[model samples]
Target: MKSSTMLKAATAVLALAAPAAAQDVTLRIQTHYNPEQTSGKLATEFVEDVEAMSGGAIDIEMFYASSVVATVETFDAAANGILDCDMTGGAYQTGKNPAFQFVGDIMGGYDTPYQQLSWLYYGGGKEQAQDLYNQFGMELIGWWVYGQESLTSTTPVAGPDDLKEWKFRSPPGMETEIFANLGASPIVMDFTEVFTAMETGIIEGTDYSGLANNQSIGLFDLAQHATYPGFHSMPSDHLACNKMVWDGLSDQHKRIIETAMEKLALRSALFFEKANAEAAAELAEKGVTLHNWSAEDRATFRKAAQAAWDDWATRSPEAAALVESHKSYLTQLGLISQSE
Candidate 1:
């Protein structure tokens, strides 16, 4: 071979090799959960799993405790590609898109964790939710439930009447409406603000996760009174990815992410259950009293909550259908009463 021709071939080979060697991509994973908390741990684990699964072809940089973005801002950040992933509540973004409220609006009807999980993954619930998200230019990658949330307050609450004269911290939409129906003054604020608000008495009480999560944040320390059976959030927590980023991944990468999420979901559900149980015991040790609602009192509260739901449903046909669908599902499974 001529020396010039040989030199040209070597140069071409190096050029191709250089491009391959320089291939690098990084994804930012954001969430409001504390980095040391279960949700944050799982998120970080998912990032690691993604890195491992992709063999370092894709690097995920995780930002927790809303460092990169606040919980309420996650949806917009992810949709706009400011962040590549987020574990957030679909309903918190209701101001951006009403359809996100569909999740929170009908969550009251899920009787069990298994039921909610089934409905979300295999029962076409996720697809419908994804359709809603896609409209906002994001995708619903995967979601997990962290069980129900109950009220933690400075004063013990056994009935709706007890809720009066209390300012309760609540999320937007249905939750606010529910609190209003119970006669509690609703305080709308982001989750991060709840701790400080409670500490400074900006709010008298807040509806947060089960015992363990609250304990981690010292929420139980601020409010010694805890109520059982959070009718509002029969289930809580969500995990999502940016739509464009999700679609841009290879099929194999998508499968890895989804599978990792499923495993993480199962782990998280169990973790939440165990944590709440343990936290209940710890609360007693720490002088926090747990109050379970009496049958009549619960019935009364439910009736009032139902009234609120009815009012909301009447205001939005889509919300009404979601509530009815979940109700029908529960009725068919004998988890709830078919009558009224």
Candidate 2:
């Protein structure tokens, strides 16, 4: 009888262990940020939060700096099951669809990170973004609007007129067109090439990362003039997963993943805000002349950006719909006049 009792006890223990083992789900994620970058740290925090929240039911293995795939190919990689998730900017997909330009980088549409995040969560922007991702066979989990990007130049850029005849590196699509409108010669180059190009005088400046990130990379050592509270681009970084993989997740696991992403987004915005401010002070002490354009000057740049918006909207129905959604929201919020 004692022998029988031992067998039963062992069976019960094995049964409990079986369910625990079956609960594990591992997701492989790729990101565009290096492990030491601010966004990269946020990615690491997100993995820890999801693991803890799910009680060990979910695991995220991250590949940093586009290690798993090229930056622009992340969407296709996730869609094809090469990676389970992609933590990168959506604007990289502009070659696939012009609509991504509107989704990824709205150019001068938003003056701050919070405004863009507000629109994404509460102003119907999320649903519209999902529509775009759905067409590509991926699910839009969440996104982060890190901070405004600054222009680093050898010369002061106080107004749109200052851009005239200047040579600089600008990302593709809207930015390239917008700068051209202001009479600046825009060069399209990879982010990795910016430093060397600047060092050799191949380019006069670059509209690169946030103030803190630019400072971290020592851009100020070469370019004396830096723009603060940047007036132009605020690129939105996204977290997306394969549609089939996402659909297969249990409702509880899905919620945990989504919650983790939302938490990361807010944390990233707040972190960049503080980091950029502190970095600006440090740069000033280092002899960098920081320029914050006047409100009038900002309005002038915004007017020029409007043309890029109109041009993008005419690319396709999807592109047109995305532009309309942004205009409607901005108009309702009094950010842009209805006549605009």
Candidate 3:
């Protein structure tokens, strides 16, 4: 995320377009992304559309790069009225409830963003996620999932067994437990240090961003071997508003915000899909070997991941509910058998 901030302002012409009955709202919002990133650019467009749709009555003061607070605190900041919305994600709130882990990034859950989205929109995820957000005094608007993240490695990680051969950067929490059980050494490190760690051979791999994002950061130059069609970690970025603020908004205004957010999600998903595809072609020319693990390997990894999910469910009733919901939905999607 970039550390810069650029305020998007609504024009007076749009202000004149507000319906007389609609209440004018000025929302102060902060996101974990910056203008330089794709997600940030899409979000800026979303805010602009919302402002225009609401005839400028829904003016937003947007801050990028978690300028108002730390990235992880964005949800709580919104809930406490420090900000009007949390344009971050649920994963950072795992400290509050293990259920958040399910909402944020269901590591090794589904193969694609579409599947994860299906569970949310078509399946029961929408209602369940909303309920989870409501408990924290926040209202769930929608989620933007770009795609699964590729694991950058110095050496080839062709299958599950390869993980044990090297120490990689891992996020804190359940992920460490899952990877550790696979006989791999998982080190928790900040994302910024991943390059230097890998350069010095302190770490052999890193659980980084999507294929395109990693390529943009020149990770492929260092770690020529990568697991494409990433097998783990597709985190959902949320657009959540404080429940009180959301409830107080005009129905039309609420719909405007929701509709705009939907567009942002779809646009982001497609953008990343195209980017990764292009990046894949570029990596081929650059001699970077893209690895897509075999189905058997994916299953093995999923089974291990599911075990961690089950253990996490034991941490909270809400977590268990979300896990069961995911299992039922994954079954419906044919990604998991009914017996599983």
Candidate 4:
């Protein structure tokens, strides 16, 4: 009888230990950041945190700098199961729908990273982004707005008027239109070509990335004129996964990823703000001219960008809806005039 009781106690102990002994899941995630960059470091930290939080049951296999797939292809790759998760920006998916532009860039809409982050979490941005991603068979896990992007130029660019007759590199969609409105000839090219194009005088400037990222890449060396505390673009980098994969995750695993991403978002934003500031000072020391637009100039650019926003909203019902959501949120936060 004592042997029977011992056997039952051992069985209960094994059942309790079963979950801990479960096989570990390693998700393959891809990013556009190289290992040395701020974003890359944060992504690594996020991976570590997830592993710790999941008690080693979850692991991340990270691929950097589009090694697995190009930035533009990450969304489709993740959706198709070639990649379990993609840490690229939503802007790359603009080719899929014009609505993505509203979700991705928003041109002159947001003044600070925190404002946009708030809209994504507290406002309707999260739901709208999820809806858009669902249409593409991907899941929107989370996003980070690191910092504003600066324009690097061989010549000075103070405001919209200064862009006239200038040649610059820009991304596709509404950004090209905005620069076109300023009378600059916008060249759409892959980001990798910016340095060579600038060196060969193929283009005079580029609105590529944040100050620190540009500095790290030596953009300031070729283009002496740079904009600081940039007012133009603040792209939100996303953490997305295949919808099926995301749905299949255990509740504990899903929460770990979501919580880790939220921590990363806030941490990256703060890190970039300080990093960009330091880069500005470093560039100034290196004899590079940095320009910060006046309030009047910013207002002028914002007004022009509003016209472009209105034009984009008319492109499709989805785009129109996204714009309206942004506008309403901006108004509630007093970032924009309600009548405007």
TM per candidate comes to 0.82, 0.92, 0.93, 0.92
lDDT of 2 by residue, 70-113 (tens): 98898899999999998897898988889988879999898888
Model 1 deviation from native, Cα RMSD in Å: 5.4
**Each model's total of backbone clashes:** 0, 0, 0, 0
lDDT of 4 by residue, 105-124 (tens): 88888888899988898998
Put down candidate 3 lDDT per residue, 60-120, tens digits, no spaces: 9999999999999889889999999999888889999889999899988888888888888
Kindly report which residue stretches of model 2 are placed more than 4 angstroms away from their true locations once superposed: 1-22
C-alpha RMSD values across all candidates:
5.4, 4.0, 9.7, 2.6
Backbone clash pairs for candidate 2 read none
Model 4 residue runs over 4 Å out of place are: 1-23
Candidate 1: where is the Cα deviation over 4 Å?
A: 1-25, 104-107, 189-203, 314-321
On lDDT, who's better, 1 or 3?
Answer: 3
TM-score of 4: 0.92
Which candidate number maximizes TM-score? 3
Q: Where is model 2 poorest over a 10-residue stretch in terms of lDDT?
A: 15-24
Better of 1 and 4 by lDDT: 4
Model 3 local distance difference test score: 0.89
Model 1 lDDT per residue over 1-340, tens place: 6999999999999888863332346878777777787888877887787778778877878788888777789878887888887677777776755545666445455645677877777666776676666777887777677777778998877677788868978866776777676778998887779878888888888877776777777787689888765555764457677777887777766777788778777877788888888888878887988887776776666566666656666655555665566556666666567675
